[model samples]
Target: MRWNRIKRRNVLETGYDCLNGIPLISLRYAIIVAEVLNFHHAANVLGTTQSSVSTRIKGLENALGVLLFERRHRGVRLTEIGRHFVAEVSASIAQIDHAVRTAGAAIDGMEGHLSIGLHSPITAGFLADLRRQYRASYPMIKQSVLESRSSETIALVRGGQLDLAFVVGTVNASDCHSRLLWREPIVAALPLDHPLAKREAITWLDLAGETFLVQHGGTGPQVFERVIRRISERERVPRVHRCDVARDTLMGLVAAGDGITLTTETTTHVPFPGVVFRLIADESESARFSAVWSPHNRNPALLNMLDLATQMSGAASFMETSNT
Candidate 1:
């Protein structure tokens, strides 16, 4: 009768529209009652009074305009329509619960997506170790990496295209928050039989006049500038060749004795046949790497990653101090 009254006032409304008006609490009560087949038992499980549970079920049945349960002297049983309704509602409630849990995990930085931009090779070193630890700690968070030039990575961070960027030098962008994570000593990549390869370490003077090969992308320009600054001061002005190629390809050319190139200590971990790596003994030969991100970006996963990096950087500094 109540349904008839509501239906009369809204003649064009669909059945789904009417169902939408029913409160979730009443639907849940109906589901519980159907599960236990007794109002008193369902009330006990729900931590409520039997009369309250019975009233909610009665209201839910009236809203549907059908008897959902057949009451007996001892308990109750579901009608055919009631069985179908309960099954559907149970599945929907399960989905709602899952959604709530997923949202909460994302908020807590335990699950979500993280996009990182970097110019450095993560084959070995702090960045590589950091990635491994982050994946272990937040296995549910999806990670993507973009390797580009330092300038491009910084631009991506400011535009909100990347959650974080690690680059080879201190970032001084007003729109970005930056932190110096670590410095890697510069190393020279040389053909194994080259005269300088036998040295434990080499100096800028040692490389002065040697033909230097650098790639056009990634840290190539930076290496070229450093080579010029360090070698040109003596007025010996080295012969530098800029090649359009990948880092690995440049290393191959170095192996073939095309020329020598500069790299950070982390890259020395990867072995190139016919090539050897030697550290530059000059104090200024190390490259300082910094992490950059936009201050306005509020991705929880990004925050978590930054926190982890800070911890790892601090630990590494402490270890270095102890060793010295």
Candidate 2:
């Protein structure tokens, strides 16, 4: 029996039957065959001979001890197991490609200092992988994070002091160019013992008698403002309470039964002893997160970061990069 080795993104593949068995080509061939349903057509798509595809597939089936496809006169039909297997293999290929891009970009890229500002740790959690990938791709480019209020982060971007900022809501600045990355539903944080915590979803009116806590100078105020605007009749709006402390402290208040607060889905990751995060019944209470930067700021590393972000986000801004 002949053997082969394929290396991609640190994932090593050896021969059809080795210490670590399974060939990359076998998985690729299986997916193509499942998609085309004809060995000859799949071979054309894979840029290989029909017999070669057949041989690899037979080896794959033998290794797995199951028939992936039923042979037919003109074509083939995938087994129930084959359909699920192909879907998983396709996802694996996507991750491999991401790893390749992350590795390749870090190698041949510009080196510079980058200052990033963020309002919440949730934003950091979402970009954690991207940041690691960026660091790997631009090892020499020093990067640091400055956790501050959204207002300050926006100002820093306007002043060109910060290269990138992940902010909540839309940014209104002539010098700053912003792109919406995602919209997450603003959920209400209530004490585990609170009456409303028992409900699956809470409404605006449900909060009429509740004390609404807003994080002073942070994105929490803007989210609250929108919640107020969403209410048509303001006959009895909840009295807003301002918290000058940090997010964790404010959540501590909720847990202490001092008051209830509203925040984004990212806060769910934050575990407080007595706080429960519940989704808002109204979809209009969604919070928008955006990436903001000064157009005039000329940083090669920042440009590279934006390109990767654009590709990852799949936003219309991606078109702008293509044009440039």
Candidate 3:
């Protein structure tokens, strides 16, 4: 009669106090028993003895102050109250289990999100290969990429807007951790009829008096600075036309014979109808790409990506040495 009165009270009325002394194991046992309707079968499925299962269910009923099952000669059947209790308990237990699994996956870097900023095209080269391998290895990680100027990419990493950034040249931020992952040789994108295009490779000096078309985004500014640094020593100022455009559009300008632009080896993978790519003869001219991230940021997905990049960088270096 007392339990009947208590049970009549709304389940939420007791709030946290009601379930304070209840063990999750007892709740689980009740769910199993309700499913199988036989104490022995439920115990078997739970890998426990029938008596243990029965005791747990009894404890759960006492804790809830309500009868959950009616014992019969054949097995057991749920009472009207038992059915409602079990249904609610089943859904709650499922949600708890899912929450536990999702938390664990996030901690282990198996499921999470990663945002990366890039200054170079990922159409081909080490960064491209690394992206493919990372995706295959951690399929659950939601990855998003944004292409911007090298300075902007590094700024995003420092400002915590980006999880990681692949940028040209070294990053000198005190708040960020940076590692040079790879280097790409500088190349010139010239029009088909450009006199220098006939050569297998051309030195930066050959680019003298030629108008250089560089974009205002991505690696454009860096490329412009590099051109000045390389050709400034010859007492000749490089004629550079900085245009606000994308890399592809800059390449299109080169094809239209507007002006030649500079790029890295990776961009050569894609063909532009009237554009030709030639390596800058100066071997010292290269773009050192680095990965930059905030030291204070502890995104597990970002850690996993850095680890993979380190491994791939080592392997790439080994392969290059072996080839030589």
The lDDT leader among the candidates is: 1
Error of 3 at 265 (Å): 0.8
- Clash pairs, model 2 backbone: 106-137
Candidate 3 Cα deviation (angstroms), residue 274? 2.7
What global local distance difference test value does model 3 have?
Answer: 0.81
TM-score of each candidate? 0.86, 0.60, 0.82
Deviation from native of the Cα of residue 129 in model 2, angstroms: 3.9
Q: Which lDDT value does model 3 have at 49?
A: 97
Off by over 4 Å in 3: 1-21, 41-52, 62-66, 232-237, 315-324
Clashing pairs in 3: none
Q: State residue 287's C-alpha deviation in candidate 1, in Å.
A: 1.0
How many clashes does the backbone of model 1 have? 0
Tens-digit lDDT track of model 2 for 17-65: 3324778668767877887899999889767899999998999899888
Q: With candidate 3 superimposed using the best TM-score fit, by how many Å does residue 311's alpha carbon deviate from the native?
A: 1.0
- In the range 1-324, model 1's lDDT, one tens digit per residue, is 112222222222322333578866676667778878999998886678999988888888888899999988899999998999888877765665667678889999999999999867788999999999999999999999998887888899989999999988776666788887888888999999999999998888988979999878778878989988888886896799999887788899999999999989988998889899998888475687888888888899999998899898883452211111
Which whole-number lDDT from 0 to 100 does residue 312 have in model 2?
A: 68
Quick one: RMSD of model 1? 7.8
